[model samples]
Target: MPKPEHPTDPDVEISASATARELRFHARPEVTVHAEAEPGGECAWGSDRTNLPDQVEPNVTYRDIRIDFRVAAALTDPTQDPSSP
Candidate 1:
């Protein structure tokens, strides 16, 4: 006896309001990250962008080398936060 085969079909799915955080990119030699609680609210330092590649690679996938959510006393304090990260 032989098993029966079924026809395969492509399935489509859509997503809305993904839970993942979006990465912000910059082409400048240096970058500073900041986040605000709300409009006109206190702003805080997010992270320091450094050791950036001189040139972006083509047709190749990239990932963040390091991500530090560990906020410092100054970074956490909006009043003491610097204009740049």
Candidate 2:
């Protein structure tokens, strides 16, 4: 087989992972993987406060989300997406 490329940052050590309880293999075992882009951002927002009789403001932050869909014992397609006819 071929070596798996680095998907996540090498600096972030992966010392723990959940067990795969959903897997059934036979003669020819296989897998399918899917991924999509996620939005991320950070900004500031205004709020209401009664203490100082002024516009209360606070900083906001957003994180990147990545979902991975995997199917066990599946086949891979040469083209990730089928060409339109």
Candidate 3:
């Protein structure tokens, strides 16, 4: 049987508490990634401390966090073709 076709645009949801110190993202099967923090929460992207919120109250749970993923590059032998088996 043939493999099913995956959606070109996919939705990914992440949940976390306000007290969470940091959030990290790792690219899977690709070298590039894009993500955004949903509204109704106090948080920011990247490692620069200046960009983060001043305070994150404890016991606060955040929902509807969404992230998007796409293929930037394949991790494989440079001499080999990426599409080759």
lDDT of every predicted structure (CA atoms): 0.31, 0.26, 0.31
- lDDT for model 3: 0.31
How well is each residue in 1-85 modelled by candidate 1, as lDDT tens digits? Answer: 1111211121211112212233334433354544333322333222322332435444433454333332212113446545767
Task: Give candidate 2 misplaced runs (Cα > 4 Å).
Answer: 1-25, 39-85
Give the per-residue lDDT of model 3 (tens digit) for 1-85.
Answer: 1111332232432333233344433322233335432332122222212223324344444343333222211122447664678
Model 1 lDDT at residue 79: 62
Clashing residue pairs in candidate 2 are none
Model 1, position 47: C-alpha lDDT score: 31
Q: After superposition on all CA atoms, what RMSD does each candidate show versus the true structure?
A: 20.7, 22.3, 15.9
User: In terms of TM-score, which candidate is strongest?
Assistant: 1
Task: Give the deviation of candidate 3 from the true structure as CA RMSD.
Answer: 15.9
Which regions of candidate 1 are displaced past 4 Å? 1-34, 49-55, 60-64, 69-85
Q: Would you list the clashing residue pairs of candidate 1?
A: none
